[model samples]
Target: MTETVVANPFEQAQAGRPTGPLVQGFEVIIGFETHAQLSTESKIFSRASTAFGAEPNTQACAVDLALPGTLPVMNKGAVERAIKLGLALGSHIAPRSVFARKNYFYPDLPKGYQISQFEIPVVQGGTVSFFVGDELKSVRLVRAHLEEDAGKSLHENFIGQSGIDLNRAGTPLLEIVTEPDMRSTAEAVAYAKELHKIVTWIGICDGNMQEGSFRCDANVSVRRPGEPLGTRREIKNLNSFRFMQQAIDYEIRWQIGEIEDGRKIQQATVLFDPDTGETRAMRTKEDAADYRYFPDPDLPPLAIAQEWIDRVKAGMPELPRAMAERYVRDHGLSEYDAAQLTQSVALARYFDEAVSKGATPKLASNWITGEIARRLNAQEIGIEAAPVKASQLGQLIARISDGTIPNSAARVVFDALWSGEGSEVDAIIAAKDLKPMNDTGALEKIIDGVLATNQKNIDEYRAGKDKAFNALVGQVMKASQGKANPAQVNALLKAKLG
Candidate 1:
């Protein structure tokens, strides 16, 4: 199960290849199967609460327990949620879809089979497009089927014995499957993030990776360009983006090494050991036929009406892609910047609110993506949890726009605002006395004093040394106690020198 492998020269982190495409030697083929746990109050087929936490089997009911007398009844709300996802993803909602028994036996599966859609899924054929660096990549979806989740097999405690918790059993899930379109681990992660944004944006799923609300299974293989497709191994249950990339990178290197050393890669399921940064084979992979799928006799064919699709469509908010396009077309923001703003609903709202409050689109975009994002990542928080409000940020940007404070002074004010020192941007600037000296006469006096003191720099500048000019600018800023506008200082100094 364990093999010692060297580092991959073509790996993403170490590859040194430019962002657009991989180096010419290898081609990576990747696909994803993501399970987005639907946001429903009850289990898909039973009245048991779908609430995440409870004492082990307390949430399991007769139907979830697969008791002999119990019959499965589909939850209307779950189907509606599925239809909503289909509409959001631009997928087709089938008029009639059949549920099948995906036969499998595990300690946690009380029914020894899972109710899922096989041949005819509820949602079919959609595309998720996202940016990997500056490159725009699109991952095409094969089908998204509705299925009930299996229970967890708890392996901790109890002297070499395992336990089964059926609380998660019958929880509704949308299994989103994609074609093998991704050619790199980076692209795969980008596609995954874009999909996550879409699901959470539409309010169908919370998309919490830590709580197991969303998870991905990545199928990866490597081949020479224009060669036949290589065998793929499925890496299962990658909950975090960090781990997802690590697992795939390791698997690709392992497969490539195996092929190079005259060994054939095997088709199997693998588990990633985050601690060791390696993948271990778990079990042989299963194809659809191995599941022995058959129509579930207990559940009837699920049908959707055109009216329901229209209803869901009418209630749908602006999708991420469309919103990004609008931002680009109307606001003159770059595609990358627009996409970053639209990563989540809250972040997008923050940007929009700032712009509506009179902040320029590009300025708001820059601050949110650069300064704000840097701080948020450092604190390990999200836009919804930011201490500073969007309106406050908008006000600060306004001050910068009107030349009330220079950009340097604005940074100081931002720090104060972020740390709760002051609520208003102007008050912070006033209290700190960080306003730029806007009076041309006052700034000219300071520039003259600096020139009189720094005769050496003036002489160097007259000799055509550009560095000396920058040094004189630095002196002017220092003389003004860092309050002088840099652009204004530059203009006045150049005029005086010439």
Candidate 2:
């Protein structure tokens, strides 16, 4: 009996895409095929070490090299990693999945064919929901299949002749294919980022695009609103998110312009030139029939047990989406801020630790998303490498909450902590003299001095000029050397002025 494939409504939308207000004139349909290299110690079907950056062919054993008389052996660890990913993504792990020979001729492929899942994949039918701005968006998953990666074809060296590095050959990869649920470049990127976070958070992939651990291929096309889907060109191997967005945006514009000029869009695979900020067609895209897939006789059908799935699920950490929802329900964070904080496992963990250390949830979210993120981006680093500890940040925020220090003084204290000026938050505040002035008598004296000195402002204020009132406030803050509590200053100023 043949299984009937029911198409989802969103998938139908991809067929005859209706342009929303976001893309008013044209329907921009985008899909992603991400290849996330599994975090395994050895290459699939081989005992060869999968360590990256090895000397050419140093890590490839006889099995990886496909020596004559060698038989393939499945790696249990690779399958376990795949199971973990499936559980994290809410995908169905196939009880029995077959591996097939994907026949292709390329210099980088030692076997002249890739052993991959075709008819039935290991994982099937899932949804990856993420926030595209504040609006929640979801991309449907077609399947995630296990596959062996091809090696690199090097052109930089060898003096005009190409060389092959088999080090990456036979590396285990889980190729995750998504439906064309994305309507714009931003949605596509958000989906990619959310997927990346999931894979890395679950310890399945390292999520390193530079080393080709996690790479995205975007299928982009444009058509008139409510028209049939346009011919899509796949942008291959977008390693960076910035490059991914640039490539998709450029491809969409190019396709639209071509259509407007009466040129038919062709289905092809393209490469994004980071330096040029453009995409150029590489080769005509191949259909599934072109690969001529056949079952690999050496390996048996992969069988997964319910016990294994349960074990993997039990071992997994809390997923990002669930944690974000918890933040919304329990901590009273907005969906946008919750999503921002959960961008990475480390960031989310940092936020939770700060809150556990007595930092207000909303305030902690603001500092992490705003100031800490700014510094981390400027330094070109991850939150895990931040100099300030979560507890320290919590203490600083607590100071702000209790009128111990104003927001301005908190910033100064944070910079001091980041610069190693002091070990403790309170010590930093003391050393920098950043404590807010809470003494009523001292504040009264300061305000009196400000009012006495700014007689011109006083006259102007009596004349009903709002600027004069602001000027007096500024003078009071200046007189107190930015240590006065802004709320206290405002209250005292209104009382004295009246």
Clash pairs (backbone) in predicted model 2: none
lDDT of 2 by residue, 1-498 (tens): 232232322235554433444453777888889999999999888888889888997987777777789888999999999998888878888888889999999998878889999888888878899998788887779888899998889998589699988988889999999888788888888899999999998899999999999999998887786677778899999999999989998998888888888999999999999999999999999888899989999999898889999988899899998899999999999999999999988899899899988799999999999999999999999999999999999888888898888988888899888988886988888878888887899999999999888889888988999999988888888889899988889899889988
Which window of ten consecutive residues has the lowest lDDT sum in model 2?
Answer: 1-10
lDDT (Cα atoms) of all candidates against the true structure: 0.88, 0.87
TM per candidate: 0.93, 0.93
In terms of TM-score, how similar is model 2 to the real structure? 0.93
What would the per-residue lDDT of candidate 1 be over residues 273-354, giving only the tens digit for each residue?
A: 9999999999998877799999999888887889988888899999999999999999999999999999999999999999
Q: Which stretches of candidate 2 lie over 4 Å from their true place?
A: 1-24, 452-471
What is the TM-score of candidate 1?
A: 0.93
